[model samples]
Each structure stands twice: as structure tokens, then as C-alpha cells.
Target: MNAASPKPVLEMRGIAKSFPGVKALEGVDLTLYPGQVTALIGENGAGKSTLVKILTGVYQPDGGTIVLDGTPVLFPTAEAAMDAGVSAIHQETVLFDELSVVENIFVGHQLTNRFGLLDWPAMRARTRAIMANIDPDIDPDTRLKDLGIARKHLVAIARALSVEATKIVIMDEPTAALSYKEVEDLYEIVERLKGQGKAILFISHKFEEIFRIADRYTVFRDGKPVGDGLVAEADTNKLISMMVGRTVEHIFPKIEVAPGGTVLEVQGLSHPTEFADISFSLRKGEILGFYGLVGAGRSEVMQALFGVTHPSAGTIRIEGKTIQPRTPIQAIDAGIVYVPEERGRQGAVTALPIFQNITLPSLARISRHGFLDLAKEFEITRHYAARLDLRASNLSQDVGTLSGGNQQKVVIGKWLATEPKVIILDEPTKGIDVGSKSAVHGFMSELASQGLSVIMVSSELPEILGMADRIVVMREGRIAGTFDRSAVDAEELVRHATGNTAKEAA
Candidate 1:
């Protein structure tokens, strides 16, 4: 506890919000002290996003009292909230690809000249100053599209820091897409923000992150505040029980399935820049895991296998047949399907109804000629939705309306409807809550037991260790090592991924 942080910089009391037929938040309370990181722990649909939306003024609360530095206030709009020194860096980094770094930072509140014109020089100088505080090497004039994912997050952080009187900064699942080293870098950035005396509210599903950076914790469950305490006094099981309203005994739930013959094989798969000479075999009824650090070509290899990217020098074979898939349709026809990590953008169409999203890839099966079969659509939708435990009002509900975890379920269900022989899940449980993760893991085991080949690419060590029958560790665009469940541990995976021997003196 900091001596200076005697009181909370921000407080929410009896906060309530509701949608048309659902109460998103109910009498929720949260307290954030200056210079201290408060981790908001919860399962998806725990009213965490609702509370955040209310705080950011995206949704005017149905009823609540927001006390800022002991003075009650209301934010009529998002800009109003930001102007009042509340800034948030979301997981997706709401930014424009065409805009420059400086432009993104000073988007709405641009520095203007005396003549009321856009002040480029002043904005650049200010952007430079802000970027220097975060990362000096980021060019202020670079287009947002030119930078990688981690750097984009950095720019978003810098934008948040640019708030003239930043009293509170909110980070929502900020490390979802980041790798090992990049995540460590983000931790350093967070520490720097803490040093600057900013009240931080970090939202994450990963308990490791909460224990690593947060001083205090606030747990939410089913639209209400369930518990609040110091992070040092909590453990994973305690937090999980509070978040899910039950003890999640089996987080992984990987069932032992005997492997069959090779269903899919990638021989000498090569991408000019992303990866090289990637050779692996996925057997029927086996869960093969791909583990790697950022830029280690994990996702790229999956993309190539799914025919999203062209493999310059590779041979793809399915069940003894050498089939070259140059497109996703071809891959699907060959009984291969991909469920991407970015479920928001790549996996699911948020605007579409759950039934529509699920039936999109397999329209032929559910459609007669060019006419869509409504009954068939609902039949397929309900089946997979139930299989994945997708929580929604109905199949007609927009996928976007669901929580992040449910959205992931919809994506997984959509791909499962295709009835592919082999499935490639890229960070399948990336931002999913613990309860939802268990369901997905159980489903993976069930699929493997049914003789469906599975390739799971994940950054979480526990997930790989728990679910994978075999693991192929990648380092610098190549296979570092391949190991069985009995042969590899967490330390061994990290060592291979990082090329560190980690030799210890006895």
C-alpha cells in the first residue's frame, strides 16, 4: 500500500445498467486507489464489460452514483468521460489503420493553431513526448497498419497516457494477443504507469497476470460485486470459485484418446518471411499442440495449413492423398477447418445472428439450391450451440451481443458444423473465461475421442500441457523440439521455445 494513496481515486456505488431484456449490472461497487492496480476478476457475463462501458460513458447507467475523488459526477458521453481524465486501452485497440501514430493519439482532441487549423507540428511534438514515455523507437508519423499487434497496443497505451489529467486508466484483456517476451514488456509498462501514480483497473481472465501486477482485486459474478480484497490473500481456486460461483475442479478436462493413423501431414511447409521447413503430422484422435513465442510462426503455420496463406515449398497430404490446398474452400473440402484466435474479426460475424453465423460455412448442407432452409438452420445452430454451451437469448440473437467467451463458443460451434476431419484451433481459448475454457477443453477431448484430428496453437502453458497429446515447439520460424506429454513439462516447453537450455547446477 502506498502512503500517498489514502483514498480511492474513483468509486462506483449501487451502479446498475440494463439492456432491453437483460440486467447487465446490478448494484455493482468498485473502488480504485491512485498509484495502485486493481484487477477486475470475473467470468464472461459477470457484468465486467457493462461496468466498463458505464465508466467510459458508452452506456449511461440506469442508476448509480459515481464518485470521482470524493465528488459525485456523471459522464454524458465517451468524450466527456475521457475529458474528465478517464482513459481506456481495449484489447482490440480501437484505432484507424490509415491514420498515423500521432493522429491516433490526438484523434478527437487535436492540437490546433490560433487560426483553428489542425496543428501538425504541435501534435507531432506532443506525440513524440508521449511515445518517448512509452517507447521512444515508435515513429510518430508511421501508419498504424505498419506496426505489429504488440506495438499497436503500445500506441493505445500511449494514447491513454496522453490524457491531460489521467486520473484512472483501464486496461481490458490487454495481454490477450501478446507472447511471452512482449507480455513481460507490457508488465514493465504497467509498472511505469504505477510509478506515475495513475489509478489502474486491469481486466484479465488470466490469474497469473492478476497475481503478478495487481495490488488489490474485485471479483464480479452474475452482474454483481461478489468479493473484493488484496491479491496477496487470494489463490486461483478462490478467485475461480468467486467468479464462476463454483469450484472449477477440472479446468483442462483432457481425456486420454488413443491415436490412429495420420490424418493430415505437412511436409516442408515454408513461408518466405513467417516460417520455414515446417513439417508435422496430425493423427486421427490426437490433439497436437503448437507452442511458440511471438514471431515464431505459430499462427502463420496454421494459416498455411488452412490454405489462408500460400506455402511456397510444402506438401499437404490428407489420409495418404497428396492434396495441395491453395484456398480455404479447398482445405475445407479436404476436411480441414480453422478457428482463429481473433474471434471478433476472423472467426465470427458479430452483426449476424447465431444461426446465420453457424450456417454460413455449411450453407450447402442447410440450403436447397440457392434457397436457405430456415428449419435446417435452426436445427444445426441449436445442436452446436448446446454442444458448446453458448449462452444467448436465442439462436436469432446477434453474436455480438454475447460476452467474449460466448462469442468464442459461437465461432467454435460454427467451425464444428462443417464436420471437418481435422480442426486447427489458433489460441482457441485466448480471451475466454475459466468456466468457458473448461467447456472448450472438454469439447476438444470429445472431438479427439470421436477420431477428429486436432491442432491447437496456444500461448498458455497450462492449456498445452493439459490438452495436448503431443507438442511441437517452434523457435524463430522452425521446429525447436517435439515431445510427448510424459517427456515435456512447462519448463521444457519454455526452454525449447526460447532456445535456452536452462541448465542448473546440482
Candidate 2:
């Protein structure tokens, strides 16, 4: 680590928090030093979110000491956290779409003149100054909706920096939506902030990102601090061990099952603005992996297949029978299911109980003559939850209260309960912990083994390589390349995904 500060900027000691059916955190401790980035490492349900929530003033700790500059403090509300200089930029940048960049930066706390009026010029200047530190090209007057995802993120960080007292910055999967070059820019911003002695709490599931940007590491497992050290002293294996409490021999445990006849075929699939000419086949007892970069239209293809969008022209064949799914009901009735990437938004109804979320699609089955069958709902939910080995306190637990992993399980079970012949998982393991990812992967294998045809759309090459029987690479909304497991490596996949030559990808 760089010459560390003698005193930590913030410290948490013996933090504890519990819920009705879960102990989210237990005696967890964390320390953040000025001028250093500390990686908060953990598996899903390991209390990382709870700790962040406490820090951000969204939740009060049941018991703990939050020390700031050698003084204990409490953030009873989100406003209090901002006033105390604790700011977070989430993976999904939460900003208004129609608002101007300057307005977003100075939304709640706009600069005022002596007359007590909003000082537009002053705010614009400050916005420009903040953008100068990140991107000089972003116009302060530009509407936020016009900028791309990466620029919106820059604005989110700028808004955080606008808080003059922001001493500690928390980045939760900030690079999840960023491209490679955008990620490089974020690293530079991080380094610049560190130079200014701003303590940073970096949370991420990608080990490569942690190794590249973090100086210190703290690992949490089962809601408790298990390890901490300089990142320089740790490797991928050691960190994995800390996160999961076991040697992670394999993240993608691909269980082989001989591929049978084609179960689903996509021929001449085309979307008006998303993807086009998508042709592929998923075999019975096979995992067909779709690999692509952001905006490569993998999810679009899946959405179209699931009847979320109408394909301008396409033919979908299930077991040699061609069908067009114009609505989600049609898709489900035709024995097709999709698990979306945005688990919090689209995959699961966070407000509903676990059993309700699982049995939602199968509601007709659980209901007779329009009367809901509560017991049958529980029975159906139990079967799939057990199949996925989901960890939760009870079937009545709200899906929102569960960790990322359990939430994902609830979504997957919701679809599987429909008894679909073909399942499309779009970024199935995104935003989940490593252990959760392994569980999802293993479950995918088990699904394939049981003759459930799977179309897994993932941006992760390692996952595609490990679990896919055949990989189809998409570039700019079309199939760029196709390869079997034995025929492709990381470089080749990158080449196809980016339309890059071998040397260019290197």
C-alpha cells in the first residue's frame, strides 16, 4: 500500500444488525484509510449490503460504533450521511433523465446567492469544474437523457464530488455497466481522488477490477469479517478462499451431458432496432452460450424470443414446430421462459413473498375457479427452491429482504415453475457473489443434464467457456462467430465479440 495515513478516516467496530428471519451482520468491523481504496469483499448475504446500507443511513445498525475522524457518529437519514460526507455511486446511476447535467449535480443542494436565489451560473461553473476532473467534453447544460450510460455515470460521480464534505466515497459495482475504456477512465478518477486523500470503499465481484484499483482488501463471510490485508499480498485463489470459506476449485463446474436433437431453432430472427439475422439452435440437454459485449443485442434477442418485443421477421421452432410468441402469455404457454439480467427490476417482485414470487407464473395452476390455493403455492415454491438449494429463512420471507443470490433463485424458480421446455437466462450471474455464481452455474449444468434446453446470454467469457456446449458470439446485433467448447479460447472469443483481429484483441 502507498504510505498509509497514520489515522483512518472512518472506522466501524463490532457492528451488528438483525432482521425477523435473518442476522444480516454480526460484529463486523471495517476501517478505511485516507488516500487508499479498500475492497469490500464478500459472497452474497455476507453483510456487504447491510454494511453499506448502514453507512448510507438507509438503515440504523442494531449495534455498532461508526467512528469518523476519531469521533463516533450516526447517520439517521440519507441526508445526514451526505452532510457527513458519505456518498455512494451505485452500479445503476440514479439520476433524473430529463434534467440537465448541472441540475442533477446540484439537485437538492443548489448554490444560492446572497439574495437566497438559485445561482445558475455558479452551479454550472462547479459542474464544469467537476466534469473537467473526469470528462471535459460533458456539457453542463446538456440534458442527462441524451448522454450515454458511461457519461451518466460520470455525472453521478460528479454529483457525489459536488458534496464539498464528501470525505469517504463508496462505489458499489460502479464499473458494472461501463465499457473497458470507460473503466480505465474510472480508474484514473479513482487515482485522482486518492491523491486528494478521499477514502474510498470499493465493492465489486470482479477480482480483476479489485486487483487493478484497490490497495487494501477486507473480506466478509457469513456476516462477519474474516480477512484483511494489502491487495499486493493476495491472489485470486486466496481471495476466493476468504470470500467462500473454501478453496474454490471451479467457478464454472460444467457437467457434461451428451447433446440430443435440436430442441429450439431461431431462424432469420430480426428486431427493428435491437438485433437482426440471429440464427441459432439449442439442443436438448445442452447449454448454448451467447457471448457479446454491451449493446451487442444478446439480451434483445432473448427479449424478442420471450415475446417482450415483436420480431419484425423471425421463425422460432420448438421441437420442429414453428411458433410466433407475440406476448409473454403466449411465450409461457408455448413452454418458453426467460430470467432477465436486472434481478431487482425485472426478474423478481421484491415486495412479494418468496413463495408468491416463485408461483406467480404458475398462479393458474395454484388457483382453482379463480380462488388462490395458498398451500399449493407453498408446495410449488418449495420444490424449485430446494432444486436450486436456495438459502432463505422461510417461504413467507419477502424477496426484497433476501440477498442477491436468493433473489435470483426466486426469479429462476418463478420461471422454472412454469415448466418451460426452453429457458433463456440473460446475464444470469451478474451482480451476485462468487459462491452464488457457482451455485447458479452448477444449477445450469443440472438443468441441461435433465434435458432442459438452455440459452445463456452472458458477457462473461469464463462462464461461457466453462458451461457452454456451443458458443455464439454477437457483434453490433448480429452473429459474428460460432464455436464449440474445444474450438475457442478467451482471445478468440474477444476477437469475435469485438470484430477484432487476433493482434488487435491482444
Candidate 3:
């Protein structure tokens, strides 16, 4: 530590929290110094969210002390925490889309005139001033919905700054959905915030972002603090070990398999505004990777192939037979299935039971002569559920109640029940813990070994590099490049995906 460096502005010691049948946190400690960014990292169930909630006053710690500037304090509510100069911008922006940017910035604490009327002019001017520090182009009078995701995030930060006394800012996964340039813009804003002497608590799963922005690091595992130190002293392997409690030897467990004849072939696939002239072929037992940036039309192409969206012009061939599917059911019937990107919304029916979700795609096969077969349903569900190592209270347990990893397994199991020839997985490991991600990777390898053709669409380059035999890079609705796994590196793949090197790499 530097001799002239400031002391921590906030200190959390011996924090403990629990819910029924689960101890979310135990004896956790975090220290945030002024003008520094501290990253809080862990696997999905590792108590990071619980600790953040406690810090934000959404949950009072079961045991511990929060010391601010050498004095113990308690924040009984979210407003109390904010009043005490702590504010958080969550993963999802919590702003009213119907309201204007100015109204959102000063929602609950609007400035009023001496006559107790809303001070519209003062609010607008103040909003503009605050936004200028982040992005000068944003209009205070525009509706929140009119702005893009990155601007909405700026508005959230502007709302935080509007507090006037916000000494500490908690940004939770702020760049999860942002484009590359938007992420760079946010990094600039963070630097400005630090320059203004605000302590920052940054939470993110992406190690690249953490290494880029954080000065200090604190890692959690199994509800307790395992390590804390300067980011300069930590490497990716060390951080992954701290989070997962073991050396993860391989994150992508891809198994080599001799591919058979083409199972699915697409020719001239086009979706008006989404994508165009997409063509690819998936061989039996092969893993084909789709690599791209956030809006490079990767997911759109996969969705079209699964019949979620009709292609304006295309030809789809399964085996040697030409087929055109107008709906998901028709795609499934033709031996094609898709596990969607937003698993919570499109992959599984959260309200339904685990077994029900698993057997959802194969209901007709499990049903008897125009009648439902409960026994057959349970049998089919249990089979794939075991294959995927799905952990839940029971098959009857609500899928919504399971952890993200388990829920994802249920989604995969649901589709596997169909016994499809081609499976398209869009961002399969997104928002999942490392252990779960390893398990999912193992399962993918197993499926390929069993002669199932897989198409993985991912923005994460490491995932694509580690698992794919061949990668197709997309840029702005078109295939920019194609590469063999042995011949291309991440830099080359990224260059192709960003159109920096538009020609095929190999």
C-alpha cells in the first residue's frame, strides 16, 4: 500500500446472513477506499448478492458492523442507505421508462419550489449538468425508453450523482448488455467518478472488465471471504481458484469426435433486418461455433434456424431431405431444437414443475392414446435429468426455485428429451457459475461424443476457442470470417468479428 493513499471510507466486518435452510453469508469482510474501485467476485451461489443487499439496506446483516469513517452505522432501509451517501446501480436499470430522463433522475426526491410545486426548469437544468459529466448528447427531456441501454445506465448514474452526497457507488454488472464502445464509455465515466473521489464497488463476472477497472479485489466462496488483495497481484487462474475453491483444470471440456455426414445445411438464410445470406452446415457429432460481438446477428441466425423467426429466403436440409419449418414445433419435428439465450423467459416455464419442463417438448411421445401418461413423463424426465446431474428437491419441485445452473440443466434436458439431430445453444453458459459451466461443458462434450451435432452461438471468445472445432465469425448480419480452431487465436477471431479483418482467417 502507498504511504500517501487514503484509508477505507467504508468497512464491513464479520457480516453474517442467512435464509431458511441456507446460510448465504458468514463472517464476510469488505473495505472500500476513496477514489478506488474494489471488485466483488464469486460463483453464482457464493453470497455476493446477499452481501450487496445488506450493504444497500435491502437486508439487514444478521451479525456484523458497518463502519463509515470510523463510526458504526446502521441503514434500516434503502432510502436510509442512500441518505447516508451510498447508492447502487443494479444490473437492470430501475428507472421508469414512461417518464422523462429528468423525472427519473429526481423521482422520489424531486426539487420543489417555495409554493410546493414541481420545479421542472431547475430539475431539467440540473439533470443536463449531471449528464454532461457522463455524456453531453443525452437530452434531459427525452423519455427513458427513447435512449439506448448505455444511456439508460448513464441516467442511473446521473440519478446517483443527483444525491449530491453520494460518496460511494455500487455498480453491479453495469456492462452485461452493453456494446464494446458503450463499455469503454462506462470505463471513462468510472475514471471520472474516481477522479471526483468517489469509492466504487464494481461487481462483474467478466474478468477482463475487473482487471481493466478494479484497483483492489475481494473474492468470496461458499458464503465466506476467501481472498482480498490488490488486483495487480492477482491473475485469472488465482481468482478462478479463489471463487471455485479448486483449480479448474479445464473450463471447456471439448472432446474430439469424427464427424459424420452433414445433418443440417442452410443455404441463403436471410432475415430482413436481423441477418442475411447466412449459410452453414453442421456435421453429425461436430461442434460448430458462432462467434460475434453483441449485435453481430449471431442469435438472430440461430433463432431463424429454430423457426422462432421465419427467414425471408432460405433452404434448410436435414439429412438429405429439404425442409422448411414455420414454427418451433415443426422444427422439433424435423429434428432441430433450440435452447434460447434468455433461459428464464424463453427456455423454461418458471411456474411449471421440473419434470413438466423436461417433458414439455415430448408430451405427445409420452402420452397414450389421446391421454396423458404421468408414469411415462416421470420416466423420461428422470432419465435426462440424471444424465444432466440436475439437482433439485424433487422432480415435482418448481423449476423457478432451482439455482441458475440447475435451471439451465432442466432447459437442456427438456430439449434433449426430443432426441433432435441438431441442437442450437445460444449463450448456454451465460450468468452461470464456473462449476455449473464446467458441468455444462462436460455435458456438451458427452452429447457430441454420442453423435449429436451442436451449434453454439456465443459472444465469449474463450468459450468459442476452447470448445469449437471450427468457428464462424459474424459482423453486422453477415459472415465475416471462418476459422479452424487450431489455426486462429482470440485476437484474430475478434478482429474478424469486429470487421477489422473482414477476410476469412483460414
Candidate 4:
């Protein structure tokens, strides 16, 4: 377990890649040895992803070489990379929606019985065996679409393991969508793989996760390898400073502000299958925080309020106007906007241009005589883009190509363009880096300062504590408890969220 070791199982020397103006990676060198987990830590635009793409054959390095198993190898495609015993499980789980878990696991290479037809029994047996090794609870016969995001990810990992991969396994934010219990399960699996002599390249934004799992660590800053050494010898402050090249005084900046009168109210909100009897209120200049375990119906409550899902029973009022929004368009018109938890799915359309995404919802406002006013559109888009400090190829660049933080900015910009009185944010900082998360928090504070009511749903405890003026805890679809800023502690919130305590009414 020492840093000074024999030849690594996989090595990248002087890897460099570039776009038209962005020098994505500049002579970054990484080594992954058998039986060690190497964590690649960096901010959003740092060269971590660039290096991974190069190693996975999604992109060819403009410079440097890759050596696997003591031999130089050139991967022409992703299949070629996998053929050479390297596989990457991305932050976004990519699996066939229409196929069963077993089929997804053995999609490319299926076992045949006698006649060379698709062999279902053999595939099911192997899939079950693989899942038993990693995660046995996932049903092999279930369709991929029916599984939760975390379960789908486990299936992806099982797919990679079914191929008998041995050299290197790269997991990019694999636990981002997982619950606390699921995260522990994933760590256990990682340990098992490490015990089997598999080299793992772990890319994540969570510092605690790296400290717990990583054997060695590398920090990338502005397209260069800024730090590389043993993880045990590194500290959080040092690692964060190296990643962003600055000292972060505080990760969550909570500003003091007075809460105004309630601007939106919900009484006995209930959904047949998702949640029930959830009651809360949001005041102007106040942030209502929702804290609960994943799938505790927090996001579902927000979705029901925003008309994404119909509630079986409930009432919602904005600014003293009782209304049940039948659609998201109506919700927006009613001065309510929802930023969904799945930013990549419900936030922005990646294939659209960044500016187009920013102005997509408010196109009618910028239109004149049934024609789009390009000048006004660009003006509004640039204003928010600059305000958010979004980095992209250009305003016209596809939203998909931008970093995760920038993509999230586009989503926020799109909603802001509507000029809503009430904004609902769900896990707004889920996958973003620390710098971007701070920017988003600042924006939220700024919006609230402008007398806009915000209801934020978050899973991270620190974020809920720092940003919210009032806190709401949900457990199994009901309001477990509510706390004002001065009345709550982390342990108390968790206790109520898990239904361990019933707090008296505020």
C-alpha cells in the first residue's frame, strides 16, 4: 500500500488535449496500480474529465501515450478501450431503457445455447451471478427504466464486471444519485473490487468520499496536474485549495436576512402514490428548506406543486391566490417555477444552444409581431450568462458541451427569464463543483433579497442549514417537523426526517 511501487497496471504520460480555445489537459500524467484506488479531484473545468475521456478512447490525446499491462496501446474507440480491459462508469448512468437488466448486462456479448439464437436462460443465470457478486437485490428481469437511478448505475457496473475486466475501472461520481445507505453499499463493493486486485480511478467532487476510499490522489487545475501524491498525507483544505487555486473561507455562505410574510402556502398536499398531507409555506425573502433521505418524497412534493405531477388531494396558493396548476406553463404564469432535481433530465435541453436554452421559456416575451427578436434574446441571454459566469464555447455552443455547472446555470437562467414570484429549486448543486455551488448559493440569496419566495429541496444537510431561513422535514410523505433558523440542529433535523422525533408545532 505504499506510493513507491512497481509498474502500474495503467499509465498515462504527458497526456494533453485541446479544443479550439480551451487547453483542456496540459501534460497531465496519471498512474493507476493494481489494488489501489486513485482519485482524480478537480473543479468543473479542471482536466479530470479530459484525462478520463482520453483513457477511455472517447477522445484521442493530442499528445502523450498510454501504457496498459506494460505495453503502449492506442485505443481507437470506446470498444477498443474496453477490449484492452478499461471501462468507465460515468456520472450519468447510460443504459438501454427498453431492455431488461440481464439484457443490459450482456447486451453486446450474449451467451448462446445451441442454435446461436439469443439465450435467455444463460444470460439470466450469468446476470444474477454478477449481481450477487456486486448487488444482489436488483432484479435481473426488471426493465432498466423501472429501476432507480442508483440501481441502474449498479447494473452498469455489473455490465462492466461481466466482461471480466481486470486492468482498470473508472467510476465518475457513481454515488451522486445514491442514498446514504446506498453509498455505503457502493463503498463496500469498491473495497471488494480493490481486494480482487482491480485498479480503480475514482472521480468525485466529494472530499469526504475521496478521503475514505482513495489510496492515492491527483489534483488538476486549469488543465494541468497541480498536485499528485498519497491521499493519506493530504488534508481537505490543501486539496480544495489545489483544485480551485484559492482558499475557501467558508463552503456555505449564509447571509443574515429577515423573513417576510408568507407568499405561497400549501395545505394538506397529498399524492396518491408519491406523498401525502404535506403542508408548508414559503415567505418572500425566505428560503424553505426540505431535508430528507433520497426518495422521501421531497422532490415529488415540489413536482406536484409545479404541476409536473397531479396531486390526488391538496391546495396551493401563490400570493393569496388559490390555484391548482394543471401544467408547468400554467405554473410559470402563476409565478411559480420549479428547477427539477435531475438537472440533466428536466433542467436543460442539452442538444439546444446555450443561449437558446436560457431564453427558451420566455420566447414569447421577446417576440415581436410573431417573429423572434434576436437582439432582445441575445441581450437577455448574455446578461444572465455573465451574471452566472457560465463558460462555454460561445453563446451559440450546444448546452450539452458545457461543464455541469454551466449547464445548470443555463437551467437557472431559463427559469429566471420568466420572472417568477416564487422559485422552487431541487438539489440545485447536486453534481456541481464547490466554486459553482457557491455561485448558485449566492444567486439564491440574491433572488430572495429581491423579495422572491424560494422553496429549495436539498439532500445535503449543510446546504439546508446554511441557506434556508426555515426548514421542513419530510418522512414517508408527511411533514415530520418544521423549524425556524434558530430552532434547529443537524441531529434534530435528521431525527425528524427519519421519523425518530415529532417536534412540537412552530
What lDDT does each candidate get? 0.90, 0.90, 0.88, 0.87
Query: In terms of TM-score, how similar is model 4 to the real structure?
Result: 0.95
What tens digits encode model 1's per-residue C-alpha lDDT throughout 354-390? 9999989999998787999999899999999888888
The sequence of per-residue lDDT tens digits that candidate 2 reaches over residues 65-130 is 999999999999999999999988877657998999999999878999999999999999999988
Per-candidate clash tally: 0, 0, 0, 0
Indicate the residue-level lDDT of 370 in model 1: 90
Ranking by TM-score: 1, 4, 2, 3
Give model 1's TM-score versus the native structure: 0.97
Off-target runs (Cα >4 Å) in candidate 1 are 2-5, 502-506
Clashes by residue pair, model 1: none
Per-residue lDDT for 265-285 in model 4, tens only? 999888888898888888888
Among the numbered candidates, top TM-score falls to 1
- Score candidate 2 by TM-score against the native: 0.93
TM-score of each model, in listed order = 0.97, 0.93, 0.90, 0.95
RMSD of 3: 3.1
Candidate achieving higher lDDT, 1 or 3: 1
